[model samples]
Target: MKAIVLEKAGGPENLHVAEVTKPCIKENEVLVAVKAISLNPADVKPKYEDEMLSMMYGKERPVILGWDIAGTVTEVGSAVTNFEVGDKVFGMVNFPGIGNAYAEFVAAPEAHLAVMPSNVSFTEAAATTLAALTALQILSGKINKGDKVLIQAGSGGVGHFAIQIAKNFGAYVITTASAKNKDFVLSIGADEAIDYHTQKFEEILSDIDFVLDTQGGKVLENSAKVLKNGGAIITTVAPDLPEGVKAAAEKENKTITNILVHSSAEDMNTLKRMLESGAIKPNIYKTFAFEAMADAHREVEKGRTVGKVIVTI
Candidate 1:
């Protein structure tokens, strides 16, 4: 198997393509011939010096880092019941073990895998898993017909999904993006797209039922001010609840939350159904060959992508 390996935590240069041994499947795992893989912010965050030294390498176990994968199951363990050899599947991989998905093969637990929809392309399936699930979880609060919702970074991977998902549930959605992306975000279902560069989001929007804050820092802080009382502020970035959210929630008695997206097979299934029904689709910002995995990561790190960036194997 040729994999982009991170032998030691460092910069993008440390991620080099090399021939590595193929992973062996456990009794409940499926061996996938990875057709495509996608990048997320989490892929780089865990490799930060403080995080790696304190949590991962500090434990004496070097790890492979990939989470979102879409591929074909070439083999299945004896205990695997949900999938079989030659089944097309996609899902987020279990972290810290065989998340070596930037390769030709990956062995993932069957419970973590879902059948890929026939109508969607492999790259779209690969890119939608983690980011889509994050948006779904963040916006899980009450959604009623004609209700208003806000999505920050609406042209990015998670934000695009959030806007579409909120719209699917009959909510009017507002989103923030660059001036260049305003039209793009609105076409994807955002009722109004705020240009984060030219104007403040809080100044133009208010009385929201939910706010999906993909950009944190002061954006997270400013987002809270625009929500109606008791409206939720959900974030994938800012692992900690932003102090502004906490302070404002304290002052006005609102609810704010921060979540590190989880890899969920069930959510992947729902996403596939939505795609097949034409209710949602991944907006791919770009695609790279597997050999260009490092470049894909660099693009994601820039934080200006219009949608998910995929590495096709």
Candidate 2:
């Protein structure tokens, strides 16, 4: 099997295309012939020194990095009841662990795999795994009809999905993005798009029922100020709240949650329904060939991609 392997967590140069041994499936796993793989912010952890990576690389063996994949099941273990040979499947495979999705084949647990939407292409399905799952999990049951929700980094992968998901449940969604992407965000379902470059979001939006904070740091700190009493906040990064936000939330009685998305077939079925009904759509910002996996990682590292970036195998 061919794979992009990383020997160390340092630079894109460390990632290279190589022929590696094919992975074998466990009793509870399925062997997927990965057709397309998508990149995320987590894939860039190697660029920073001493940063705690959500995914680990093997020091002795070549580490394959990636979690989102849309592929076909070539073989299934005896315990795999939900999927079988020739099944088109997609999911975030083994997230928070060794997903090893950046390859021609991957051994995915049955629980982490979902049947691909029949109407969606492999590339589109691949684009929706981890990022879409994050958005779906964070906003699921966290907001309701007529509620006002605020999402940060609305033009990025998770942000884009969050905006569409919030709107699906009839929530009025406000989001922050660059001036260049303001119209793009609105077209995708955001009711209001605040240009983070020139305007202050906290000053303009108030009494938000939910705040989906994709950008951490001061963004997380200032999110509390815009929420109404008892409003809730969910951040994708930095589980801990800054002292200022904590004080504001403590005084105002607002709730907070930090999102670390988990894999679920039920949630994937929800996405399947959305896709089939044309409720939520994927915005693939870019696509790279299998040999260009390093280039894809470089693009994601810039942190400016408007949506998902995928590599076709």
Candidate 3:
């Protein structure tokens, strides 16, 4: 199998293509011939930071860095009942752990995958796994119909999905993006788009029932200000709230918490249905060939991609 192996933790240049042994499947896992992979900020971080590299793979040198994958099952584990050799499957495999998805093949837990919908392409299915799952998990039980919801960084990977998911739940979705991306965000279902460069979101928006804060630091703190008293804010970026932000939340009787997206077949099925029905659509900013994984990382590191960046095998 061909894989992009990380030679060292420094930059995209460290990601080099090499021939590697194919992975073997566990009793509950399936061997998939990877067709497409999605890039996330998580994938980009480990490339430049040893700390993040150790956290994700734990001293494994020449590690394969990826999780979001869409592919066809080539072999199923003995205990895998839900999938067969020919089934098309997709998911964020072993998230917060080793996924080894930036390759021609991957060993995915059967429980982590959902059968890709017939209406969704491999690239689109791959794009939805991590980012869509994060959005679905964050807002599933937290949002209600007609509530005002704010999704920060609405043009990024997770933000784009959050906007559509919030709207599907009948929430009045508001999003923050640069002026150039304002129309793009609105087209994807955001009821209102705040130009983050010019307007302060807290000043223009108020009483937001829920907030999905993708950007941390000042953005997370500012997002708290716009929430209605007793409302909640879920941040995917900030692991811990600053003392001042915590104090403000406490004073307002609001909830502030950090979230890391995990793998879920059930949630993947929900996303599968949404994709099938066109309830939510993936806005792919670009797709790179498998050999161009390094270039793909460079594009994502720019922090300006409007939506998901994909790599096709």
Candidate 4:
């Protein structure tokens, strides 16, 4: 099997195409013939930082750096009952762990995958896995209908999905993006779009019931100012809330926490239904060939893609 392998952490250039042995499946895992892979900001971190690579894979050499995949199952584990040999599946496999998805085939746990919606393409399904899962997990059971929800960096992968998901739950969705992407965000169910380049979000917005913060530091800090007294802020970027931000949240009786996205077949099924019904559409900014994985990384690192960037296998 052909896979993109990283022997050492350095740069996108270090991600090299090489012939490698195919992975074997565990008793509860299925072998997927990967058709598409989604690239996340998290995927790029380990490629450049040695510590990140060690932290994620624990000193594994020649690591494969990807988790989100959409593909057809070629073989099923002995204990797997939900999926057959030919089922189309999509999910974020072994998130916060090794997925080894940048290859021709991947061995994914059955619990981590959902049947790909018939209406969704492989590329679109791949795009939805990690980013959409994060959005779904963050907002589920957190916001109510008609509540005001703010999603920061609305033009990015997770933000775009969060906007749609929040709106689907009947919340009044507000989001931050540059002026150029204001229309783009609005088209995807955001009730209001704040131009982050020109207007400070906290200065003009207030009484937000929930905030989905994709950008940390000052952005995360400022998000606290707009939340209502009993509202909550969920950040995907920051590991720890800044002291001042935490103090403000505590003083106002608000909630602030960081979220690490995990794999869930149930949530993936929910997303599958949404995708099938067109309640949420993945805005694919671009698609690169499997051989152009490095180019995809470069595009994601630019931090300006309006939505998810995909690599088709």
TM-score winner between 1 and 4, please give it: 4
Off by over 4 Å in 4: none
Per-residue accuracy of model 1 over 195-277 as CA lDDT, tens digit each: 87889877878788777887777887787788888777777766365565587676876677678767677777888888899
lDDT of 4 by residue, 96-210 (tens): 8999999999999999999999998999999999999999999999999999999999999999999999999999999999999999999999999989889998999999999
Per-candidate clashes, comma-separated: 0, 0, 0, 0
Ordering by lDDT: 3, 4, 2, 1
Which of candidates 2 and 3 reaches a greater lDDT?
3
Comparison by lDDT, 1 against 3, better one: 3
Alpha-carbon RMSD, each predicted model: 2.1, 1.5, 0.9, 0.9
List residue ranges in candidate 1 displaced over 4 A: 48-50, 53-62, 95-98, 239-247
Candidate 1 vs candidate 2: the TM-score winner is 2
Candidate that would win on lDDT: 3
Q: How far is candidate 4 from the true structure (C-alpha RMSD, Å)?
A: 0.9
Candidate 3 Cα misplacement greater than 4 A, ranges: none
Candidate 4 matches the true fold with a TM-score of 0.98
**Whole-structure CA lDDT of model 3:** 0.94
TM-score of 3: 0.98
Q: TM per model? A: 0.93, 0.96, 0.98, 0.98
Screening candidate 2 with a backbone cut-off below 3 angstroms (N, C-alpha, C), the clashing residue pairs are none
